[model samples]
Target: AQSVTQPDIHITVSEGASLELRCNYSYGATPYLFWYVQSPGQGLQLLLKYFSGDTLVQGIKGFEAEFKRSQSSFNLRKPSVHWSDAAEYFCAVGARDILTGGGNKLTFGTGTQLKVEL
Candidate 1:
């Protein structure tokens, strides 16, 4: 069984400030990791993913994450955040489950609500 846990339920950041969001997961094997951001009344958009290659993966919208196998963590970071970046962020993991129909199923964390101020 695989599961994801995001420590912070909500976060606030000033415009142009650095940001970091923590994520932890539990899985038998190294699963496919992903980070997604969702705006109000919108679907999730992929930020980045960790499959097999690099430990650190860069994402769209000036975001990046590092996969730490030992710590079972994948934390998202941005050098500077914009006000438009205020939204809900979710950390997800792709794992094979009998309930899923062949395609990868994403197990998402509770979600981290981001609030960016001017």
Candidate 2:
């Protein structure tokens, strides 16, 4: 079974500061990793994803993530945080399978609430 764990339940950072959201996942093999963000009263939006190749992947909104195979971790990072970036971030993992139509099923983490201060 594949599962994701977000160690930090909540994180507070001042505007213009750097941010890093930790994520760890357990899977039988190299699984598809993703980082999503959900603002208050909004739907979940994908921030970044790691399928294959390129350990460091660039994503939207000046965000990036590195896939660490040894650590089973895919941590999201932002060099400069903004007030509008405050949201709940979720880490998800899914297996890719031809039988299951590319393994659409995704198991998400508990999520980390990000709060930005001015």
Candidate 3:
């Protein structure tokens, strides 16, 4: 089974400052990593993903994530955060569908709420 952990429950950052959200994963085999953001009413939006190739992958909204196999972590980062960037961020690990051998399954972390101050 694969799982993900987001240590911080809430984080506050001033506008224009850099931000990093921690995400640690647990899996037996090589894992696919992803970061998704959910606003108050909207569904989750994919921030970034790392399945293979580069360890660092860029996503929408100026967000990027680096997959560290040694550390068993895939942390999300943004160079400069905007007020609109404040939301609930979820870290997820993708798993293969073993039973049917089709599709993919994702296990997400609890989430971290980001609060931005003007």
Tens digits of per-residue lDDT, candidate 1, 12-66, equal 9999999999999998887889999999999999999888788999999999999
Q: Estimate each model's TM-score.
A: 0.93, 0.96, 0.94
What shift in Å separates residue 77 of candidate 3 from its native position after superposition?
A: 0.3
CA lDDT, candidate 1, residue 78: 100
What TM-score should be assigned to candidate 1? 0.93
Question: Rank by TM-score, descending?
Answer: 2, 3, 1
Model 2 lDDT tens row, 1-118: 9999999999999999999999999999878999999998999999999999999999999999999999999999999999999999999998887776666789999999999999
Best by TM-score: 2
As a TM-score, model 3 comes out at 0.94
lDDT of 3 at 66: 90
Clash-forming residue pairs, model 3 = none
Model 2 stretches with alpha carbons more than 4 Å out: none
Give the true-structure RMSD of model 2: 1.0
The TM-score that candidate 2 achieves is 0.96
lDDT of 1: 0.93
